[model samples]
Target: MNDWRSHFGFHTTPFTRELAVAQRFPLPMFDEVLTALSRAVDQRGSAALVAPAGTGKTALLRALVDQLPEARYRVHYVKVTDLSKRDLCREIAVACGAQPAGSFPMLVRRLQEHFLSTLADDGVRPVLVLDDSHGLRPEVLGIFQILTNFEMDSRLVLSVLFVGQPPLRDLLRQPAHEAVTRRLVHLATLRLLSRPESHRYLAHRCTIAGATTIPFDPGAQEAVYEIACGNLRATDQLAAKALEVAHDAGAAIVDSAHLATSRRLLWP
Candidate 1:
């Protein structure tokens, strides 16, 4: 029988298969975010999720959207890195399936009206997900405050969720932003994965990629854990490179040498 390594190309590494592998990796903190966001969505309150880069914030949001039953909610995902109020409004209008019939201000008001009406008709609140919200300008963010006007006494007609880096928490702390910050009833700050968690993460990804057994040697796992520093992105990168190194060396199983090469390629 041909060796497993011989069947797959030398360049076929876990990194190249990240999308497929990542889907199978059980993000442990995902449940926390899901619970928090689900509560916020159900309660019709605002939510803020803050985390460092590569802590899987975006992935969590996508997963949350996927898990939510479509019959109950309409989720609109937006990335607000560098947008003017008008542009932001336009994006929201588009996502909500409303066409603005007049000037930007008039369009915004119309969009707001349309959103509230749609929620009322559908019997389900609308969820607007703002990714990288820290970069939003004060004026653009003010537009978000305007959206809060759609709320009723019982629940919000529209709910907004802000996901961003650590600075977002600091930004919200400013006195001028207090009104908006006060509306955020749900919040979560994601942290790097623990060592054991990281191990499970890597194993999960490898298994998803068709590896029946742990691909890396015991010592190699330690090296990967150290080099990845508990970051999922770095872990994926290292694992991919290690797989490539093993493939190129014609090794049936990944070992320390492959990990060493992976480290040099990733960090250097």
Candidate 2:
């Protein structure tokens, strides 16, 4: 147990990365993005979720998986950072419970068959979440043509979601990657929070972590916002460390000075 968690009278650690889906911060923008992506998958369409690091893309995906009904949607999430076409095929095969051994062409064919069978036999749609896709080379992204195509482009049997950083938005716009870009029916991204939102978010994280009262005073909240610039993950890190600094000094509430010191410890 961290000394700060005990000092603050929290039942659990505040501002942590490990949060339950039910306990997720109730941000309206998160719900909006999830609904749009859910609607696209419902219609058997592809989509992209582009967000900068620490803006909560991964947490959003967790909520997305929960939103998709297990009985109706065969959702498989595979993180695709720097993976080759064959490596990606193997990862998807494993996610779908298929043997992950074959030539690249054979793997593709096998995956298509598995997706089709899942839909035809079980009345479930297959949704592939290709996460961290900004690392994919343009040529590697071309694999989407085969995955999304079936029966000479007459059947739509698979729905894919590309979740990645901002570069992914530009990568999809390149002419060489038009095939995959054209297949996307919805695009979404998370924005950095405004100053007011940052304060509310800090309080929410505190409450959810079982705090009776938020320890960060108004000035400390503003200090964190100034340094983290309203990024969710950044706020988490800054607030958590500031609490430690305050605890070390035997301070009951965190203040701007503690936040300033925490920033230097973190970044410098």
Candidate 3:
């Protein structure tokens, strides 16, 4: 099998999810959100990022983490899973480099002390990033208020950033979760790319992969935008399959016909 990278004159596969920080495309949609999150972090406040699936929510989180200065922020990223409150605290304890073996109540106190000591001893703000928080159980999410409370929530010792899909926003809006919602300094949302932006997005991916010229033709790009509706993950899947179809056909450039085949193979 001909390697797609070499076949397409790319140093690496384009449209991959695991893009290096330096190689990540600048997403303008996230600029305001980045600023808001950074401000929240500086103020030791909390923020929520809501977006539809495949719209680069995780990517935006990574970008935000990358932009934050290490000297000022100790960022700990956690991908929330369906777990009991005790298990969740264990996960957080591990992330913060604290002992994870303990009773539920003891674990909470230990994590709290770790956060306080991280600030008092290291003099760097600790920012906890929870990705896919929409999956968190209501009871588990509620624990955040208790975890963040220091001196009755008057002194903010830890900044928390929650990144999730729209369901997360709905979860936060419920009266039951008011304790967590009230602490939110900002709520940012991400949208799919526009038509023109989709074109540039593809080109940017290609350029970063070491392509001097875009291998996807204009019509093919339009087909991708139409099929994926500008969602980054969908676009990436369609574009990657389209490239494979084009390469298999010994085509120099991906065209509408390749995209059509990709849509059929990928969706059907």
> For residues 1-268, what per-residue lDDT tens digits would candidate 2 score against the true structure?
5578978879898888898899988889999999999999998999999999999998999999998899999899888867788988998899889889989999999999999999999999999998898888777888998989999999999999999999999999999888889999999999999998998899889999888899999999999999999999989999999998999999999999999999999997
Model 3 clash tally, residue pairs: 0
Ten contiguous residues minimizing lDDT sum, candidate 3: 21-30
Candidate rank order under TM-score: 2, 3, 1
Q: Rate the local accuracy (lDDT) of all candidates.
A: 0.76, 0.92, 0.89
- In model 3, state the lDDT of residue 112: 87
Kindly indicate the candidate among 1 and 2 with the higher lDDT: 2
lDDT of 3 by residue, 202-266 (tens): 99999998889899988998998999998999999999999889989999999999999999999
Question: C-alpha displacement of 258 in model 2, angstroms?
Answer: 0.9
Highest TM-score: give the candidate number.
Answer: 2
lDDT-wise, the better of 1 and 3 is: 3
Pairs with steric clashes in candidate 1: none
| TM of each candidate vs. truth | 0.87, 0.97, 0.96
Model 2, residue 11: C-alpha shift (Å): 0.7
What TM-score does model 2 achieve against the real structure? 0.97
In candidate 1, what residue range of length 10 has the lowest lDDT sum? 4-13
- Clashes (backbone N, CA, C under 3 Å), per candidate, total 0, 0, 0
